[model samples]
Target: MTRREFILAGLGLLGAAAAGGVYSYVHRPKFGELPSGDRLKRMQASPHYHGDHFENLVPVPVMSEDEGGHENRFVATWKFLFGDKKGLVPAHPLPTEKTNLLALPREQDAVVWLGHSSFFVQLGGCRILIDPVFSSYASPLWFINRAFAGSNVYTAEDFPEIDVLAMSHDHWDHLDYPTVMALKSRVHHVVCPLGVGAYFEQWGFAKDSIHEEDWDTEIKLSATLSVHILPSQHFSGRFLKQNPTLWCGMAFITPKRSLYYTGDGGYGAHFKVIG
Candidate 1:
């Protein structure tokens, strides 16, 4: 073929690829359509659901300039471990006992942040864990890396008779495999958004003990405590294929008060609606 013709063909391919990427980004799924099973199936079948968009809300840190001298030293240490050339270990280290959660107060009216999206809430003589990720790093592959500092504040052994284990979504950071396995015997009930129960079932949680709810659905835990599945602006994926399950936030309500957990999300107009 002529050189001009070859170049024109290459340009045509590039244009088509760029157009496809734009189409995917502009047409990705929104959280409002997630609750219905039929709507979720339709979204899963679409090509736009798994595509990447280049939008950024928060400014990216200029590593060298913004990190100061200490960050440079830390990066140098990380390179020595996981660089392309010589390295002793992986990208990060496994967190030690220094980060683990020690003990819950016997008074039973407290909340502790377990790093990332996990939390332990003690109220009305009940312990509730929300979207616990106790691992070093949030990754499907075991060999990658882990959180640089906090590993696990509390292991499963530290928990005493969990009343409700709640999950906001199926993402690795929100729904960790190891943490779920540890809670299998101690947790009495597993609460999750629709289709998230599949993960619990796969992890050997009893079918009857799992409660799946759509958006706005409510489950009563006790005379004074209840939980409701709420909407979130996020996507779900564990592999290259995406949106096989659902994602959401949660609202915890008691006779005296209500608390909202906004999982991982971008700021949307729904915040006004929530208020």
Candidate 2:
């Protein structure tokens, strides 16, 4: 073939590949739906939502130069692709142990580490599940952020009826698509900050079941159990639009015990505020 013809064919192939990728990204359920109508209005009501994006309580030192979300994302992606990652992943399967969640006594409080950022806390006679990412990989694409072997032993089906599905943020790692979808029936209610409940609503959860709140607010889950949605130094977005939804840390306070989850945020004064 002529060099001109070969170059033309290569360009055509690249165009087709790009188009295919765009289509997959648009139609896939894994990408999730953005907030609209009442959800958007509710989000706008929050003091955090400024203009088109959400903001931290104060100018976060970690994100002072974050006026451009797209640029920060580009830098992050560049690092993920070509940056040094020598010991980021384990070379061998991680040692893991499984617990029969159903057999655990609900009356006796306990905490279970499902993997990564996921946790199960039985407190104040309530079965509380937090950040339950049962999927092997946290990213939208399966090839990236693969879990260590033997670490992903638990699935959404393994859990018993959950009283509270507490989500700290809407990041893919914390708010897993498949795991939450499967547990929706088992989850009695969901507690998320600000705009994060839009995902649950779009995924067919009843509006009444989703309790969306702003930071610095405390939710009385029961007479003896309460949860505090507090500020954190972090940005949120599943796709490109950063901080469209709020990111937060949580404080679960019971009569006899109190626990906190940082939810992927960097250290900030919010820690003292949580106290």
Candidate 3:
């Protein structure tokens, strides 16, 4: 083919691939279902829920001044996809430690980091798993955004009976459909921000198994275990739309100690307010 024809053909192929990706995303069942009817009404009545979407207590731009604005997200994303990533990853597989999660004593308080925002914590007789994502990739595409080597060491089988499965948000990385499906039978309770439970509901989890809360609300799981849902300067959504559900941090407070998990968010006055 001529040089001009070669370039045109490449562009045409790229356009075709993009269109196919869009089509797949629109039809994918694992993308999750949205809230409606009574669930939608409940979300609408929430103080943080605006008529069209959820809002953070303090306003923070989705893109910063340094990022250059809304359009710059695409630029940054392009750079991330194509830029030189020499030191972006470890040269060797990262080392890991194996722990028998099921065998651990209930009296022994501990915390285990399971890559990214996922963690398992045992405090005050509660076995809490936060933002558990065991799937190979963070995105809906099975092959894209694969987990780093050696970072994905734990799966649902590694976990004991999760007394409380705390979800930070509805982002694909935090809430993996396959992982959640695998864990649903093992987990006792699913706790998350208001409207996020709709995803769990759609996944076929019992309504009694899911608990949704607004920011600053508290759920006392047990006599010694209480979860405080606090303000976080973040927005949430899994699809093209944004902030259909609320996003916030979680503070696990026990009679003897307290631990806080900061979900995804931007720096703002809410940080000081949280402090």
TM-score of each: 0.63, 0.87, 0.86
**Candidate 2, clashing residue pairs?**
none
How would you encode candidate 1's per-residue C-alpha lDDT over 1-275 as one tens digit per residue? Answer: 89999999999999999999876754433111222355445434433333321111233322344344344746764874577753533466556443233365545467777767888877666678899877876765455545545455567777777788999877777878777887789899888876677667656789888887766679886787788876666766555434555566787787655778886767765566666
Error of 3 at 171 (Å): 0.8
User: Which candidate number maximizes TM-score?
Assistant: 2
Mark the 10 consecutive residues where model 1 has the least summed lDDT: 53-62
Candidate 2: deviation at residue 63, Å? 7.5
By summed lDDT, which 10 consecutive residues of candidate 3 come out lowest? 63-72
- Write candidate 2's Cα lDDT for 92-183 as tens digits: 89898899999998998899998888899998788999999888888887877777888889987799999999998888889999999989
Q: Residue 251's C-alpha lDDT in candidate 1?
A: 79
Better candidate number, 2 or 3, judged by TM-score: 2
Flag regions of model 3 displaced more than 4 Å: 1-25, 65-70
Question: For model 3, how does the per-residue alpha-carbon lDDT over 1-275 read when each residue is reduced to its tens digit?
Answer: 99999999999999999999898777666788788898889889889888889987767667645543345677666676676778888888789886889899987899988888889999988899999888889986665567888888888898888899999899988988889998988989999998899889988999998889988899987789889888888788887888998888999999998998888776777667667
Q: After superposition, how far is residue 271 of candidate 2 from its true place, in Å?
A: 1.0
Please report how far candidate 2 places residue 159 from its true position, in Å: 0.7
* TM-score of candidate 1 to 2 decimals: 0.63
Model 2: residues with Cα > 4 Å off, grouped in runs: 1-17, 61-76
